[model samples]
Target: MIWFYERRGEHLRCEIRQQLEGDQFALVVTMPDGSERVELFEDSRILNVRSVELEKLLRSKGWDGPFARDI
Candidate 1:
């Protein structure tokens, strides 16, 4: 799954996908500057926790989304 957020015309992207090599999940974040950050999770519970935390953080910082696509 993927989500996008924007503020002042800059975009932030988040993607969740399963890794091909193992039973792990990846939460990838793409910053507005084009840099990337990755977090690996062993289970869905923690992944959901972190995902929501990031969403709240971005919203508090004045970004608007979890849009289904880039806007």
Candidate 2:
């Protein structure tokens, strides 16, 4: 899998990952407490999400930082 990630100081981090096979994707948000919330998506759902929606999803999961694009 490949990840696109952003860090918010030492408190939080979030990453979006795509599998090598390209069948599914996952969003992983890491909180200050070192716990993670991961959600999996089908290819269509992942590909169809807009940047705004992505940020919203992150916020809902407790990440209050700007979104980062995949490098």
Candidate 3:
């Protein structure tokens, strides 16, 4: 299971995890950088989100793409 969150003045945080509720999965949250808030979402919402969507979300949240790529 994976959950994601964005907070003021911080990088994106994602949680990758696995759990079993009698064969179900545990909720996971991955954040390389600590955040002020973590948003909990529905299980259904975690379904089939692509990397492109992530990049778009990051951009929408003011994540500037790559650094010094052309340098």
Candidate order, TM-score descending: 1, 2, 3
Off-target runs (Cα >4 Å) in candidate 1 are none
Clashing pairs in 1: none
Write down the lDDT that model 1 would get: 0.94
lDDT of 3 by residue, 1-62 (tens): 33344455444444423333343333333444543333333353452353346657766866
For candidate 2, what is the total of clashing residue pairs? 0
- What number of clashing residue pairs does each candidate have, in the order they appear? 0, 0, 4
For each candidate, give its TM-score against the true structure.
0.93, 0.52, 0.33
In TM-score terms, candidate 1 sits at 0.93
User: lDDT tens string, model 2, 1-71?
Assistant: 22233445545556667768767776776766789888777865554474458667766865556735445
Please say which candidate is ahead in TM-score: 1 or 3.
Answer: 1
- Candidate 2 Cα misplacement greater than 4 A, ranges: 1-10, 20-22, 44-51, 57-64, 67-71
Model 1 lDDT, residue 43, Cα: 95
Model 2: pairs clashing at backbone N, Cα or C within 3 Å: none
**Over all chains combined, what TM-score does candidate 2 have?**
0.52
Q: Provide the lDDT at 26 for model 1.
A: 97
Model 1 Cα lDDT, one tens digit per residue, 22-63: 889999999988999999999989999999999999999999
